[model samples]
Target: MAHITIYTTLLCPYCHMATNLLRKKNAPFEEIDVTARADLREAMRAKAAGRNTVPQIFIGDEHVGGWDDLFALETTGRLDAKLTPRSD
Candidate 1:
């Protein structure tokens, strides 16, 4: 599986939803709470191309954007290929 990282805030509903979707799909991910870390929040903003939003998701070095984007991918039937573990 690809390395999944999500930049999130404590009180963000989208963040929770995003993580919940990942959990439901059994996708492995690391959650970074940017609300408690100013530097990480700034980094997330930079990665998001100046959009200061919660739940900025990255899947294997690919910037997958926010919760809406993630859900969109699933809806479009593209998220599984990126999330499924590769067999050597």
Candidate 2:
């Protein structure tokens, strides 16, 4: 499986929703809490292309945006492909 990383805040509902979906799919992910860490938040912003949102997800170095984007991928049947490890 491709490595998953998600930057999130403590009280963000979207973050919870995103994580719930990942859990349902049995996808292991590294969750970075940027609630009280300015440095980490800055790093998240930099990696997310200036998106200061609570949840910024990355799947194997590919920026997957926020919860809506991730859910879209799931609904469209593309998320599994992204999560699967590439033979190459």
Candidate achieving the largest lDDT = 2
Model 1, range 3-84, lDDT digits (tens) per residue?
9999988899999999999999888899999887889999999988887888899998899999999999999999999897
TM-score of each model, paired residue for residue = 0.91, 0.96
Q: What RMSD does each model have against the real structure?
A: 1.5, 0.8
**Candidate 2 structure quality by residue, lDDT tens digits, 1-88:** 8999999999999999999999999999999999999999999999999999979999998999999999999999999999996798
Q: In model 2, what is the error at residue 88, expressed in angstroms?
A: 4.1
Candidate 2 least-lDDT 10 residues? 79-88
Which stretches in model 2 have alpha-carbon errors above 4 Å? none
Q: Which candidate is the best by TM-score?
A: 2
Q: Tell how far residue 44 is off in model 1, in angstroms.
A: 0.9
Score each candidate by Cα lDDT: 0.91, 0.96
Q: What is the lDDT of residue 7 in candidate 2?
A: 94
Clashing pairs in 2: none
Cα lDDT, model 1, residue 7: 94
